[model samples]
Target: MSDSRVNLGKQHPAAYKALIALSAEVEEAAVTAGLDPLLVELLRMRTSQINGCAFCLRMHTRDALKKGENPDRIAVLPAWEETGCFSETDRAALRLTEAVTRVPDGHVPDTEYDAAAAVLTADQISAVAWPATVMNAFNRVAITSPYPVGG
Candidate 1:
């Protein structure tokens, strides 16, 4: 018999359930922290896109649309620095999103941190961090699991 391990979805039921539970907690924290849900979804989508996480990008793109994020902005997310589609708050959040997701290059620079902090309250910062952290975790899972992209 072959010795290859099965996929997580097929082999590890309990871990999958735990991930779902942790995701719920992250969502609750984002909401309770007074974050704009749409913005949180946008951040998730952007980070997922950067990480090439097809599962999360698909999931969060739908969630962002549901919360009334402009389709135009969603289309232009990869070029956020060049577009005027996002508000100052959104730009700040996006900067933080990039910093968090791309971190080992250097510490999150003070300029990005200060910009995000200026637009977002302490609670809002926490809220944004939750989604960033969650997306990063999900990215790793998808990457390692070699999850398929298209059916």
Candidate 2:
């Protein structure tokens, strides 16, 4: 089969625009919920990583770096649980992001939800979830469209 694929964002501009609007809203919500901007980027990156969305991973990774996220933290993001680079809130957000990204694995388990609840307020938890949700949708679009990840 040919590698050619329709760019979903361009193929249906209205739907893509709606998604973009939702992303902007999510960003505002994240900020209003008192989530650190760096943490928001990390959540986006982690969700992209889990979905194997190279297009998104590259974008969010660059965003994270531009926000002054430590390179070491980004490097060890996949193994976040094993590192001391993240704070309690960061860990909670990461765990929730993973659970949200891997929903088909078994859905978000009680352990994950409870863990997040233990450290994050209701607003914070919702903030983490919305980014993960938006990232997952964007990942599906980019992956299905086979968005090019140029060097």
Candidate 3:
């Protein structure tokens, strides 16, 4: 399909605004919780990838790169479990991000939660969760709305 076919900006202004506002709130929470901006973007990209949210994947991949994330790491994110590109903290955050993003599978298994909790402080978890929740919400919105992908 042409890029204009998936252009969310032209298709639903009100819905887009609401999603933007929600994203802003989540970003504020992430900042307050001391989550690394790059990490947050990475998590968003990963979650978006899992949900097939092309718009988000495109947007966040650019954002992550602009924020100094290593392109090689981003390229290998989907295979993070098998790669050594991520740090311990990044691994924890990614695990939590996946769990929260795909909660219907089991609401984040104890092992995953424990591993993330062991590396991140309470505040960090809160911050990370907020972004993950917000991204998931937006993912649904984009998916259900059938939001346009480009242009």
Candidate 4:
């Protein structure tokens, strides 16, 4: 066995392009549904964090910061529940993103769904899921392809 792998996106350009298109559509949907662009980036960061996708975590973290997200919020994101840094809507979106990313844990249990529904409108809920879903796919691509990360 050798330490070598194909870059999935390069090997399968069509599928990768489709995923990118889906990501664009999801971005539009999130904006139309009234999700703050920063919040959307946070959701992406959270999903990447959970999935251990360093590539995405770096990308979305920079995106969030460039959009004026607080550095403290990003630093405290993994322990969000223990902090008062997040708003109710931020908390709801984070929880929902966690559930979607960790679906294998309990299959997006009603508890998580209910928690999100409590703070999010129907469109907002749908909007949040799209990012998480798309991030998960991207994470898989990056992790399996093992996209290189560097300082």
Candidate 5:
């Protein structure tokens, strides 16, 4: 164990609380946007995967499976752009999630936003962006804190 490490969520209870609240709002937005719940989890999982957040990867992968996401899709998610396994809606959302998660790459290329806008309703586009934003925040929290994963 690193003696210098702190659980960011535990150490900053109010910030974590705010994130928890934002998470609920994000979920509500996703549900109201008519995104499939499995798609929601997949977004979270894929974002976590990009962030190298093992804890969230485990948590969201479990959530995805519980929501009846195809195990094959989960396995191939890292290569989503090349796979025909995902629906067009899934492809759009996944692309948006990846772009949002990797904002350091280009501050979210306009092409990415345009691709999502082309396929998703305005509300759904907003919905997808929020969760990806929130997940990126959570990924930073988890990765910086070096949160433990697995049993």
Candidate 6:
């Protein structure tokens, strides 16, 4: 960790641009799917938390609060199942996010997908999955670079 790492985004500007564009498109799709802005931010923060991405967690946590996400919800995200603060839709998305983010531990299972599908429409499912998918990629990029947080 003592050695500085290359900024993959800067080293390959085109790839970073592509990822940015993809994220924009995915975000628009998620919005079009009628995801609550706060919910989306919550999912983003939760995925980042599971990935141990400090940068993402800090950024998304701030964004969530700005968008009116509950502080208690944010605080208890890791134990979401133990709380009744979230809706069925939110729970499904969180579950799906965990499944997608933890793919190395176990391939995303059909049961998880089915559970999400049960509570979410097709587009909503895609909307949730895409962010989790992209966030995983972005998490790796930031973690590899060990992006600094705070001013």
Q: Would you estimate the TM-scores of all the predictions?
A: 0.86, 0.96, 0.84, 0.96, 0.95, 0.94
lDDT tens digits, residue span 1-151, model 2? 1378888899999999999999999999999999999999999999988898999999999998988999999999999999999999999999999999899999999999999999999999999999999999999999989578898
Give the lDDT of residue 43 in candidate 3.
89
Clash statistics: count for each candidate: 0, 0, 3, 0, 0, 0
Q: Please identify model 1 stretches exceeding 4 Å from their true place.
A: 1-6
lDDT of each: 0.83, 0.94, 0.84, 0.94, 0.91, 0.90
Model 6: pairs clashing at backbone N, Cα or C within 3 Å: none
lDDT of 1 at 109: 88
Q: Put down candidate 5 lDDT per residue, 1-151, tens digits, no spaces.
A: 4768999999999999999899989999999999988999999999998888998899999888887889999999999888889998999999999888888888889999899899999999999999999998998899889587758
**Local distance difference test, candidate 1:** 0.83
Q: For model 2, what is the error of residue 32's alpha carbon versus the real structure, in angstroms, after optimal superposition? A: 0.7
- Once fitted onto the true fold, the runs of candidate 5 whose alpha carbons sit more than 4 angstroms away are none
Q: Which sections of candidate 2 miss by over 4 Å?
A: none
Model 3: CA > 4 A from native? 1-16
List pairs with backbone clashes in candidate 3. 6-148, 6-149, 7-148
The 10 consecutive residues of candidate 1 with the worst lDDT sum are 1-10
How high is the lDDT of residue 108 in model 1? 83
Compute the lDDT for candidate 5.
Answer: 0.91
RMSD of every prediction:
2.9, 1.1, 3.1, 1.4, 1.2, 1.3
lDDT of 1 by residue, 79-115 (tens): 9999998888888888998889888879688988998
Native-to-model Cα distance after best TM-score fit, residue 92 in candidate 6, in Å: 0.5
Tell me the lDDT of candidate 6.
0.90
Pitting candidate 4 against candidate 6, the one with the higher TM-score is 4
> lDDT value for candidate 2?
0.94
